[model samples]
Target: MFTHAGTLQHKFCSVAQCGVLIGITIGYTTTTAMSMAAVKRSNCFHKYGHGAACHVPNNSFMVIFAIIQIFLSQVPNFHKLSPLSVIAAIMSFAYSFIGIGLSVAKIFGEGIGKTTLTGIPIGKDFTAMEKMWKILSALGDFAFSYSFCFVLIEIQDTLKSSPPENKQMKKATAIGISTSIVFYMMCGMLGYAAFGNEAPGNFLTGFGFYDPFWLVDLANICIVVHLLGAYQVLAQPIFGYVESWSKEKWPQNKLISKEFSLWGYDINMLRFVWRTSYVIVMTMIAMIFPFFNDFVGLLGACTFWPLSVYFPLEMYISQAKIRKYSFTWIWMQIVSLVCFIVSLVAAIGSTRGLIISVQLFKPFQSES
Candidate 1:
């Protein structure tokens, strides 16, 4: 079903779009891992004092992972799995089930803890509700950029620090940024056009935003899987470094033995701890405030504004020897300031609603 749309309008759905959308989605997720890896690499430099430790491989690992996941998600035989892969199959099934199920919950005005009974009446326009909505939107809007802006800031730092010979790093960072912006804009536009005023709370669910369920599902799954892999990129380096240190600290202990491995870079303990933490934190967020769109919107704005807008301009002003203040630079600053303001508004407006979810997720009937 998803493939059909790609085929139907090859222009809007060309190989480039497929590649761009999937690549950017994966890049965004993968960059998190890369950032983690960079952090880990920095640690390695600090601990062993090896200059080579900070040398991160400038590769398209994120893109490869995204492509593989996208392809696997569409494989016909995946739906008809053998007994050996039952667990894998079931995990995939579970993702689809929960992903779509939670997405649908928002459309009926049921998600985000707002019930038909207690929700502000659609036609009832009290001064309180208006103020509440604005503040909630502000908070959510700002928070949405939490992850995004960090990446931008990191990229700027990298670009400024990298030697001119490190062309590969520059290329990779450029690809990551350019692709991400395009993807975000396209997805946001499509979602708004499709869902209009009745969009769902989730970012990728495409509930009221887009009707092509299977395509949207595939996209969401690809995105989620890509993001999951990204977690590993960071985890591996941190765990590896920690394990190395632990071995040095306690060479004879069996507990430390299990924690570190000299070969294959095994770090099961670290994986378990980090993944458990991630799941717990994300689940709390999901359960508490399913107003995903507002959350995403705010986060995006905050992140992009700080990194892309503020950090870049600030750094440029401080670092570069200027003959005069360029109009382009001034214009960029203005744009970033506007984005920051908008995001702040969205975040404050939406925070009240996170509390609202406690009431919504209260003991609903379970399907047997």
Candidate 2:
């Protein structure tokens, strides 16, 4: 609401939101494929030995995920995705708990893995630069995790006005965000404590806990299910934007504007062609990078400043009409500045990491 429709600020905000949406789509594609690979790898390790080479090609999995998304994207619009989103959220919680539980088991069984205050030390295997990159990338991951505010407004719109929507939303945001933070911290801290400096970016996929292989497979399956729904949830905004723009631009074109019924489902030619192509392109990008950490860090760092920090702060200031240079205004500005710097450094670190990953990566490689 604060964007003030038809203004330049609205346009910029739209671009930022779209950037975030696309970034999330790509990130989900990459992660879901990895989860699929992890499930197969888990079975491989169980059947054979943990040391045996059981490499799964990520490209195939990515393509399969894209195909599923292509079918799901045909759903009329974002609001129609409520059921899928709910299911996805449930799956998310399932995997998060499983991950934490696995970590706790590891800590109890093996004791804590080696740890240090400064994190992984400078050695022949890891350099100071790499270490810095890791720290920044980790910050990026945190930023991404907490960047759920983008949907806060939409969620608030769904609440009844009997309780005062703003007040209700305030309480909801507080409770939801606090609960999420605790869960995230628990999972992160426990994972770190269980396996310290060598902690994997994805505890489940990293094979940090190989045994109880069935549980690992189940967790990975939850992740895959979550991503299946999440990929469409994230893609909906993009599809809405493109489809709306196309209709307006080509109002008379039947291909863009016409809708038909297919067994109680609304099918539009533009949506079919455009959405399918979009998924395919995203799948290819996922296959090409397939460096989960670097991609997450890059997306999180690049979008976090504008979407999660800057725009919200600016909107709040404008809405609140806080006096210029007032204490509140100044503090808000300081926070924004700090966040911007964090985003910049994170972007640089993730970029450097992505470069290194690319140097070592082979596109569509069948084996690790």
Q: Give the number of the best model, judged by TM-score.
A: 2
Count backbone overlaps in model 2: 0
| Candidate 1 Cα deviation (angstroms), residue 33 | 20
Candidate 2 has an lDDT of 0.82
User: Residue 298 error for model 2, in Å?
Assistant: 1.0
What's the TM for model 2? Answer: 0.93
lDDT of 1 by residue, 98-152 (tens): 4444345444443333333333444555567665685456455434434443343
The candidate maximizing lDDT is: 2
* CA-lDDT, candidates in order: 0.43, 0.82
